[model samples]
Target: MEIVQIVGFGLIAAVLILVVKEQKPLYAFGIAAFAGISLFLLVIGKIDAVIAVLENLSERAGVPSIYMATILKIIGIAYIAEFGAQIVRDTGQESIAVKIEFAGKVLILVMAVPIISVIVDAVMNLLPTGG
Candidate 1:
């Protein structure tokens, strides 16, 4: 059933791309992007299920919850950044796309800071302190 839906959508997207290519190139790009987003949303339910499974596995394996959350956050940020960059590029705003990518990187770094600080603090605590 899922495969059928995916193939059906893929075909529709291909046809839209071809039609838009002849008539409106920009709109062709837009349609392509819209198709991608639509497909993503369609499969988002599977993502939730996968996350639940991963959470269960991580708990059974004694993995830290924070680590799992951080990984998921990173994945989310990467996906969003890529999507934004592609849209900007499609709109012919290369400079803005570059800035958007830079901003995404900065945001990811900021988000990771807490994990980094924790590691740094742990290492520092392990060092012998001279009185």
Candidate 2:
């Protein structure tokens, strides 16, 4: 039911944007951006719930809190960057949108470095030592 409402809202927004785009392109862009933001906000609670579940599972698995936090931040960056890129793309800025996505990928890789190092260390420890 909630998904239906969301879809309906999105469809209505799309129609409104199309109708206004001919006479007022700026308004059409505004409509698309607003719709994207509104939809993001609506799903925030669900996102929080998922994060809570992941945190609990990580704790149970004895994963360090820092690792979990870093993972969550990476996820957040990906989502926020994609959202921003979409909004900019709506304004017909393809290059800016691509740049935003590129930045997000770079940031995610940077954030992942510590985790990667830890994994490499663990793997090295598991290997046979040279006599």
Best by lDDT: 2
Model 2 lDDT per residue over 38-102, tens place: 99999877898899999999999999999999999999999999999989988889999999999
lDDT of 1 by residue, 15-104 (tens): 989987988987898888898788878876788988999899999999889978987887788778877897778768999999888888
**Which pairs, if any, clash in model 2?**
none
Q: For model 1, what is the alpha-carbon lDDT of residue 119?
A: 88
Residue 75's lDDT within candidate 2 is 96
Clashing residue pairs in candidate 1 (N, C-alpha, C atoms within 3 angstroms): none
Taking all chains together, the TM-score of candidate 2 against the true structure is 0.97
